[model samples]
Target chain A: MKLVISIAGDNLQSPFDARFGRAAAFCLVDSDTGAWTAHANPALEAAGGAGVQAAQFVAGLGARAVVSGAYGPKAYASLSAAGIAMHLAPGNAPRTAADVLAQFQAGALNQAQAATQDGRH
Target chain B: MRIVVASGKGGTGKTTVATSLALVGGESVRCLDCDVEAPNAALFLHPVLDRRQEVGIPLPRVDTALCTHCGKCAEVCQYHAIAVLGQTTLVFPELCHGCGSCTRLCPEAAITEHLHVTGVLEGGLTADGLEFARGLLQVGEPMAVPVIRELKRWPPLRRPALEIWDAPPGASCPVVETLRGADFALLVTEPTPFGLHDLKQVVGIARALEIPAGVVVNRDGIGDQGVDAYCADQGLPILLRIPMERRIAEGLARGRSLLETAPDYRPAFQALLAAIQDRVNTEYAP
Candidate 1:
């Protein structure tokens, strides 16, 4: 299973990006091998519908679950359709991607059943 | 020629100018208040709005019984208006652009379309004999272009010698729709910083659409010459200037035209019209 985490930098130590659709980058981790890679979010500057596009990109990457600080209604809907569980990163924010991944692996993070906030109109 | 009276900033007197022009031009003019979201030129023009036509957009509807849930419709929608989850498909009409791509691309032939009323187009005749029309967008309707389009076409005849379009304030999609096929953009502005900033934005839109524009400086004595200097630098003529006077505003508050407030400006407006005709003749002649 692969896990995708919205992030701010290319490394595991980078802060988790709270914004799902317009996040600067996404950190994808191989659950079995503990190997990971970062991809710059192509939907960061999208004119509109960034949330749905990002959700599609994450699903295309074969991510079984996603970790992020927040999820928008559209992103939540799309990810749910793709059968990917969404996990919120623990702490106020700026929590490292590795910390979020560890908490998820440790079963500390909770799965989100709905969107945390509204998105752009 | 169709002349659009636009103000990049709000409260710069687009309606005042447009309504006055319509009143002055009388039988030869067709006045279209295209600011559908807040159609207020009627307040001053007092057109007897008797004709009403509801405007709507085509929205997609899925026939679940025929749908195979292949997710092809979801994949084809650029706005994510449709989503397929498991064996169920969801359609979000608010996000749909009504391109009919989902209906045409669906291999299962499950998608259909239905009309959704978004606004109404109203037509009437002013007491002064000019044809008047306006669009009223339904509250909370995100789209205004359809209403404006319907209003523009509701007149039944484009044979009027001139069409004065009272456009909405701003350089957004609604403004673009209003300016689309206009022969000239009679831009109204106040000589203020905010007015100057927004004027530049609208100017860019007009230039992009290849429409000629002129400036009308309202509330002239209240602010600096930023707008004047900008216009001078850009070679745009300042056609008319209404002084910042309380009496003129008081007359407007009472729903009176500029000609009603002070008849002295009647000749000025006429001269302004003549100048526009001369410019259009020499520069815009086909």
Candidate 2:
């Protein structure tokens, strides 16, 4: 399964970014092989609807799950409709993207059923 | 002649100057408050609304039966208002600008348009024989351009009347829509840095639209002369300078026309109109 994590830098060791749509970069990890690739988030500077576009980008990448601090309403709707699971990362303290993936592997994260914030409509 | 009163920064007395202009112009002028998001000119004009009409935008409605999940609508929507997920298509009406691009480009011809109420346009007259109109944008609606467009289209009194538009702040699309085709744009600004910054932006808009514009510096004595210097350098005329006065603020707070409360300010507004007319005539001469 492929998992995508929003991160602040262009590598797996980078700190996990809480924002899903406006994240600086996305780390795509193959769970079975542990192979990871970093891609810049094109929707980061979108004038509007960044969340929806980011969700679409992730879904297009065939990501099975996304790890982030929170998901906006539009992102949540798009991701949920694409059958992609959303997991919440530790927000109070800084965590690396790799740390988030490790926590998810250890079953330390919670799956989000609804959006955490109201996105601009 | 159509003269639009606009400000780069919010709360810089656009309404105060606009209402005072309309008041001083008397029955010869018609006022349209295009600040649809928060129409406050009515508070001072107190026009008795005799006509009201709901304004709406045409949003796309997808016909699922004919839609092949081709994602054409979603692909054509620049605002991400439509999202096509597998066999399902989701439409966010609030984000839609009603451009009809999606409906026109849909391959399956499965998209149709339906009117979504964005606001209301009202027309009436004040007790003093001032014809007034304003647009009230629906709360939570992101779009204001359509409402302003409708307000502009609202017919004024049959006789020739000087149309004065109380424009919304900023150089956004709404302001552009308000200033479009206007004969003159009266930019209202404060003498502060923020005010000067926004003034330059709105002035750029007016210049881009090729509309002659002048400035009205409200609360002139409170801040530095940076705005005046900037306007002078740009060769933009400073039509009026309304000094900072607590009494003017108090009277406005009470929803009283500055022309009525201060009386002395009436001549200033009148001269402001004359200056605007002079600039418009020289620039637009045949």
Candidate 3:
């Protein structure tokens, strides 16, 4: 399974970004092979509907799951419809994407069951 | 001539000036309270509303039986108002702007337009023989332009008479929409730094839209002369300066027009109207 994690920088050592749509970059990791690739988030500077756009971007990349601080209603709806799982990262603290992926592998993170009201438009 | 009474900041006496002008202008004046988010000109004008019409926007309703689940509507929606999930498609009405693009672009012809009520348009006559109209937006509605458009398109609005529009605050889309096609714009501002900052934005919008505009400094004596200096530098006419008075505030609180309570202030409003007409005539001369 491939997992996409929102990040502030374009490297595995970059801190995990809490925001899903406005994140500067996304790190796509292959869970079985432990290989990862970084892509710039095109929705970072969108005027509106950034969350849904980001969800579409990851879904197009065939990501099975997404890790972020929260998911808006539109983003949640898109991801849920595409059968992609959502997991909540730890707070806004400076944790690397690699650390988050490891936490997910160790079952230390919580899976999001529904969309959060944190940043719904 | 159409004169829009607008302000960059709220609570700057826009309705006070607008209603006062409508009252002083009398039988030939028609007032439209275009601030649909919070219509308050009627509170002061006290117009007897005898007509009410529902204002609606065309929202898309998907016919699930005919939908191909191709997600074309979701792809075309800029607001993310629609999400096509497998065999199910969901519509978020509040997020929809009723642009009808999705309905038109649907390849399977499964989308149909449905009327969604956004607000109500009301028309009536004030006790003093002035024509009055206002748009009241429904609670929690994000868009007010549809209601304002309906109010502007009302038959009485196009009649041969003096038209005064009390626009909403801020230089956003709604303000631009209200100021469009007006012969003159009366920018109301208080004499303060924040007031001056926002006034500059509204003025910029008016100048960009190529509408001739003047300034009305409400609460004139309370703050410094920054607004005055800015207007002077811009060469914009200072139409009127209403002095800051506790009596004016008290009267407004009781929903009374300054023209009715003070009576002496009626001339100022009338002069303001005349100045607007004169400027429009001179600047727009053939």
TM-scores of the candidates in the order shown: 0.88, 0.91, 0.94
Off by over 4 Å in 1: A30-35, B155-158, B284-286
Candidate 2 CAPRI category: medium
TM-score of the candidate numbered 2?
0.91
* Residue-wise C-alpha lDDT for candidate 2, range B1-286, written one tens digit per residue: 9999999899999999999989878687789999999899999999999889998899999998999988878788888888886567888787788899999999999999998999999988899888999999999888899999988987776553688899998889999999998999899999999999999999999999999889999998998989989998999988998999999889998989788679988787788878877887888688
Q: For candidate 3, lDDT tens digit of each residue in B66-85?
A: 99989899889988777765
lDDT of 3: 0.88
Q: What is the iRMS for every candidate structure?
A: 2.3, 1.3, 2.3
- For residues A1-121, what per-residue lDDT tens digits would candidate 2 score against the true structure? 8999999998989999999989998999997788999999988887777887888888878899999999999888888888899999867898899899899898899999899988784
lDDT of 1 by residue, B1-286 (tens): 7899999999999998998888777587899999999888998888898888888778888998999988898788888778776566777666776788998999988988898789998888878877888899999778888888778767544479988999999899999999999988999999999999999999999999998889999999899989989999999999999998898899988988777888888888888888887887877567
Candidate 2 lDDT score at position A25: 87
Overall lDDT per candidate, in order of appearance: 0.86, 0.89, 0.88
Ranking by lDDT: 2, 3, 1
**Candidate 1 vs 2: which has more TM-score:** 2
- Candidate 1: the clashing residue pairs are none
Every model's DockQ, to 2 decimals?
0.33, 0.54, 0.42
Q: Clashing residue pairs in candidate 2, if any?
A: none
